[model samples]
Target chain A: MRVSKFDRPYESGRPERHQLRVENISLSFGGVRALTDVSLTCEPGEILAIIGPNGAGKTSMLNCICGLYHPQKGRIMYGNHNLARTSSHHLPKMGIARTFQNIELFRHMTVLNNLMLGRHVHMKKNILTALLYWGWAEREEIENRRFVEHVIDLLEIQHIRKQMVGSLAYGLQKRVELGRALAMNPGLILLDEPMAGMNVEEKEDMARFILDINEEWGITTILIEHDMGVVMDISDRVAVLEFGRLIGIGTPDEVRENPDVIRAYLGQDHGGRS
Target chain B: MMATTQCGVFHESYRSDMQLRPTTWQRLRVVVVFAFIIILPFVASAQNLRIANTVVIAAIGAIGLNILVGYTGQISLGQGAFLAVGAYSTGLLMHYYELPWPIALVLGALITAMFGAVFGIPSLRLKGLYLAVATLAAQQIVGWFVRNWDPIDGTKADGAARELSMPRALFFGDKLNDSEFAFYVVGMIALVIVAVVATNLFRTHIGRAFVAIRDQDIAAEVMGVNVFQYKLVAFATSSFFVGLAGGLTAVHSTNISFERFTIDVSIEYLAMIIIGGLGSISGSIYGAAFVKLLPEILRDVGLWIADQGWLASGQLDQYLPFAEDAAFGLAIILTLIFEPEGIVKLWSDLKAYFRLWPFSY
Candidate 1:
């Protein structure tokens, strides 16, 4: 039988296509291999979902893409630039932004400040200017604040703009985290379990926001999610991982019908759905 | 959550413009504080002035410690050692090279910052208790070398006898060997350092990164902050301020000794930050004043009680010696248990309560 559109076979991008590419990536923590020879590529403006069992190294792959982890073996290429060798600090500048599996909002700061921190990569003011709050610093601050406000509106978190992130509800906090990542205005965005513990309503809201972010923002999105329903609904393509190896790669319908992918989910009642 | 409700209307008003202090009352408070500081020298007694100067200098050190320990969450027992570097460098430069006091002070701070950067190398690899131990070891090694090395002190040895001398002050052609002069000098320097640190800390990326790292290192790293570089910067910045305080203390006093900058001094700084409220610039000043003056007050009270004929002089001496130490220990324990947020927090809370009174439910 022909593979479903959801499980469409991997097609190499055109020669001039600017996209993020991972080649033969492998990462081992101590003796445990978190990822082994895992390769995936995400094109601009495409929502690629990496769905896997609990220990299938979904988050690990995201980490490698953002330069959080230097794979023992692999090359992460972003828009023709080799990122594996670049400093992690330079990732945001290189148009890559990420949110954590566990919401990583700056708890003590206001939601607005947390988002503004994302703009730190692009801020051009020096220490002297920042200290004096003069000249270019004031202009820079105003510009960044406007950009952060735009992100807050985009994430639909204007009500919680001045609220401390720690004080916000879980769903709002997640949204604020998304706002923070969006403030970076990256060409590629990574979302790790964005809807991890949310109820159905919250999950729906998050899924809509994620879809809007990818579509309206015109940004490439790589999502690691356990909610197969949300993944199937929003993802243009899906990559299924089982024990550090990609079991299947295609569109959602194709992935849903893959025998290996079904067996990986059925082998153990992972029960990750909320 | 319960305590949050008790916050007063003034706090609520201030909280509305938390980042922007646009209120007239808030601006008035700043003016009042500056006025009090300006008038303090004239109104305080000689002994009080001396004590206030010590508090100011100690506050500078505590501010540095707050940046490292309180904000960055790096426990450093070696801050006193950095202070020693500054103090000794300033003392040596002023005494032997006849450098001006201002030049000596600047040079002292620069050298100390450099030394702090050097010592910060080990922190790139270690954290928590292990990092604390490393800094403690640094303290011991730096302290020992400074104490033993005569050349560093600008002193020549004469058959095992160590003759230490006080640095001379040359400001406005009038020598500043008196307590009042030292008090003014230290106070001005302390004020300048506090203002610079308070304003610069939160406004800069490095400062924000330090706080982020303190909360969660892995999360911060993932956000593209150079965790190692920021951490090292915190150590270096904290140490520079600490060293400047040490140099000021050395010049402020008539005599110099190794015992003054011992591990005990470092612990004292830690205590100040703890009691003052961790992660607060103003708290450092409050903590420093309380720690420095509390003993002096106790000593005076003990002396007064001894003169009352209710207690024998010999008995008083035996009991009084331990009394101050015991009182200080109890204060720390009680503060930790009851007011973990420290005196500055309590003060702010009270002020907030007053501001929001009647409507504060």
Candidate 2:
């Protein structure tokens, strides 16, 4: 199948020195503060992990970055754009994509169709061409399918490509969610608990994919996980948050030894075990 | 022992995988079915041909409803209203403005689509039963307006509604006879074109977006699908086909009463999609045929019973009409209870069962 011209990656030429700088981003729901005064920076092609106990505002911060939840104060600067103003629907077109903490896949759709939707922003066929679907529409469809097949290959999900997402096992469903995000060919990908309820083997495979996505694909990544072993093994940098407050941000080793991070985890009886 | 058992057809590419009929056997089956349909008019009587025309028209409307409710997960009870709009608009344009029927048909579809989009706006804030009730209001509003509006003297003195009669269908200045006009122009040819267009639609990004929204709307949003815009497009496109079906119906029957586009017609269209299979183009056609033929079958059975002299003819005839309605309702209930995936799934299961014949596994 021929890949459509639109399915090609966005050529910004050489990858620019992209950086996502979140400065003092504060978020709240009425009286309940979810994230307060959280600041972090992710450099180009680096895998940054955000780690915290439950309700430590890790997902909230990712939501703020993805434009799903606008902060009450501060700014999220991705290169030149202010992400706080960007609508979640427009984020994908602007080269930002994310997965959900709970797998948010189109459950009734086949895995192929779900991943093909990741290329929605790149598809340019209008209704007229779609109805006439033999010429331009078919070409574009084949092209998009080629890109989706690449994602399926990368995620090693070729066996269940035609299976419905709802019928798949939980581990495979998480991988499909990752494939769906990668199908967007995003410059900056946010992964919210991508390896949440997986076995040790599944967690290792997910970590390897994340590392490959960041290094080989030259895509920046923000991963949120409760598994400290996976986080420390793959992440280039780590940021710690405690009850809506940023407690530490540094290289994985530095953040691991930080006293405030230890107090926060130990105080809540979260042993930060593997 | 046959160690080298044949698997099904291999789809080497997404292109092949997406093909409507990928296997040789599937292609052969389709060809045989189409050949049967093409030769049906030659063998069947005029009355049976008329029933076939009704089936095709109903299929178009059913496909439209399936797109909204089945693929897009937006329940709409306003198909009857949209059909009325299409029929009335086409009728008025052809009669008063002396427009060509083809142009009038397109304009009628466009008008009904606009109406459908307006009704779909409420869907942004409502869903499920709430949205269903909101669309039901469209039927009432359109029905009331058509009955009372006197600009075209819509209401007759005897309390019967005015009929919208279509002009003789002109194709390159030649008048087509009733069967040619109805079956060729408005039935088979129209169905083929609509079916092809619909199949092509499901293969594209827009169609995938509709399915995504149906499955998980919040997920669809994060993936860059404009949920509100796509919802409106779904409504508009569904109404477009239903409106075209409405125009074709007027042309086929030569005259249409406002009473024809009632709530009962809306329910029948919904039942067609549900009983046939939701979110499937071929399923829509099967559903239409089943629903449309049920009444005819009941009538034939009634006549046979009366001829046997087992019962009084007048008494049997009186109850036979009610039996048709009861049978229709029972079919819907039974289908939902036994096979919620509908007849298409059931048929596929049977095919699979036979394919693995002589091997219980």
Error of 1 at A170 (Å): 1.8
User: How do the residues A139-182 of candidate 2 rate in per-residue lDDT, one tens digit apiece?
Assistant: 89887777788677778998888778898999999999999999
Docking class of 1: incorrect
Candidate 2 lDDT score at position B237:
93
How well is each residue in B1-361 modelled by candidate 1, as lDDT tens digits? Answer: 2224222334332123334445667778888987888888888898888777888888888888898898888988887798888888888888888898778877898788888877778888898889889888878897668667757543445434243476667556545557575457655656665656455656555566777888767667766688887788788778778878877877776656666788888888888999998988878878888898888988889889988987886887788769878888887998999998799889978877886786875
DockQ for candidate 1, please give it. 0.21
lDDT of each: 0.77, 0.85
Query: Which number leads on DockQ?
Result: 2
Q: On residues B1-361, what C-alpha lDDT tens digit does candidate 2 reach at each position?
A: 1112226667678667778777788889989988987788788887887788889889988888888998999998888998998888877787789888888888988988888899999989898999999999999999988776664444357456776666777665544236553455446877888888988898899999999989888889889999989999999999999998888776665666788999988999999999999888888988999999999998888888888998785888789878988999999999999988788888877776677677847
TM-score of chain A of each: 0.89, 0.92
